[model samples]
Target: MTEPIRISRTGSVETWTINRPESGNAITGKDVIAAFEAAAEGANADIAVRAVILTGEGKIFSAGGNVKEMADRQGMFGLDPIEQRWAYVDGIQRIPRALGRLEVPIIAAVNGAAVGAGCDLAMMCDIRIASERASFAESFVALGLIPGDGGSWFLQRAIGYERAAEMTFTGDRIDAPTALAWGLVSRVVPHDELVSTATELAERIAQNPSHSLRMAKRLLLESRTGTLESTLAMAAAMQPLAHADAEHQQRIARWRSS
Candidate 1:
């Protein structure tokens, strides 16, 4: 049986690929939870892995959910339609929360179409790099649903409230160039070079001090929801530990010698 997700590593960069290409790489609710769990565990346990790259196996990154599975589940349970849909929402919404808590940086290599929850997944990552052929859409509204997978949070933070509202309301698809212009992705590259460019960026990040990188990620996450005064206090508490690290000392000594 084929795995829903595939993991590989290149040096300190771990790559997780969504393997269901026949479905436009769509992820089921179960798949989203499982993928996030596996990726988070792998990144946390391996000291050698300083960064992670998320992508999809074939032509598309992800089309979002497995609609056929949804249909089958509804048929099997014969449950109230609203209740069944809520179950689906609960399962898939955990993915972004898991990604957000990861200690290391994540780079989404958007190879093709990323719609609905798929677009949320990409936006949750620390950085996104897209291929020329990549497209994105906040497609939930068109289906009479809302962004359930933390899309509202990440999208609003990424491109601001107006743009997020526009995309979510219209469910309009945006190409890579427009995505970049709208600050959805960090950069766009040719289709053939997407993986290479993303990998290169990951490698560059991995070369930095891993502990410091993790701490910086924590600080950045904290700053998002923390009040200015609280953030300042947190930073003050963290500063001494950062300065006391052996890596920090070594850099200081080197600077003094120069």
Candidate 2:
């Protein structure tokens, strides 16, 4: 069987593509855990990989979780359930947290529809770049499910509580331009240029000192919940470590000589 996720590397960037195009890249139960593990391992292992780009094959970025699989599990476990639901939630949470925890940057290249968990998947990335064809929706409410992934956490953070509440409650789809206007996406390009534009952005990030980028990502992620004074203290502690790195010294010397 083919891998549900395809991973490729170019210089300091790793691109992860959701491979189930026929089903609009819908993730299966197994795919969710596997993809998360793979991404986390990649981030941990490769010091050279400074950024990650997430995209999907063919038309749709993702249609979210496999509806058929959900139906099948529902049939097996019955209607009123708890254990199975929690298991599914656990799997969903793992993927997004893994993506968010990665020290390097993550950029989502949304080529088409990113519905339900798919939308959360993109939101989990540090930056999102969408194609003109892209559309987003929380979608879980329509399916009689809550956002099982880190959707609740990230959505509120991304667009604020009111907007996130509105989207989650109504389950209405938002177009690329609307997403950009709402600050949900960094940029929107023509469908044809989506991949190229994301690659260019990733390449730019890749050119920076990898250690500095990782440390900066760490600080930004940590700052979300901490007090300003605490965050400042954290930064103060990190600055000397960054300055002491050989990469930082070399760059500083080059700047001085120039």
Candidate 3:
């Protein structure tokens, strides 16, 4: 059987596919969550891996939590309400937390349907690029549930509060064009070109100074919750490190030549 996530490396970029195409790439079990967490941790430790691409096998990106599992009251939906609460904390929630700590930037090459937790997964990435065939929905409410995997936080940040609220309340799906209009994804590509486009973008990003990329990503995330003064102070602190990095000289040389 295939793994829950198929991981492959090409030079400075690594691609991770949510491989459960049979279930629309839903977070079917602990294996999916664990592997995702492991991948983030591994990427964090590996300095050579500067960027990551997350997509899914088959047509669908991810259906979020498995609705069948939810209906059957299995997996995270196992046992009672109290059990489910801790399950979120211990299970699906781990993905965002692990990813938040990742030093490398992630590009979500959303391939197809991204519903419920699936949508939230894309939101967690540093950058998002969608295929023309891709669709996103904060669809937890349709199941009489809320985004248990932190979609509320990530979604609003991606497209602001009002738009995010509308999507969450109605559990409505928006197509790639609509998503681009709302500033959710940076760009949309032909379905066939999604991977190639994303690879080009990721490689371009990876070619930059590694230390600066990580530092810049951290600053961007922190600034989301930080005040202007604090953000500036943090940036001040990090600037020295970036300047001191060995890549800085090579970058300056390349810049001067250009």
Note the Cα lDDT for every prediction shown.
Answer: 0.85, 0.86, 0.92
* C-alpha TM-scores of all predictions: 0.91, 0.94, 0.96
Model 1 lDDT per residue over 58-128, tens place: 98899887667556754313558787677655677667767877899999999999998899889889999
Model 3 lDDT per residue over 1-258, tens place: 788999999999999999999899998479998999889889888888899999999999999888898788776676688987887899899999988998989999999999999999999999999999999999988879888888999999999999999999999999999999999999999999999999999999899878899999999999999999999999999999988888998778888999
Backbone clash pairs for candidate 1 read none
> Model 2, 28-140: lDDT tens per residue?
45664677678778776888899989999999998988887677765323445676676665666678767766889989999999999899988888999999999999999
Point out the worst 10-residue segment of candidate 1 by lDDT: 69-78
**Model 1 clash tally, residue pairs:** 0
Residues forming the 10-long window of minimal summed lDDT in candidate 2: 73-82
Question: Which candidate has the highest lDDT of all?
Answer: 3
Kindly provide the TM-score of model 3 when superposed on the true structure, using C-alpha atoms: 0.96
**Candidate 2, residue 52: lDDT:** 89
- What's the distance in Å from true for residue 4, model 1? 1.7
lDDT of 1 at 214: 84
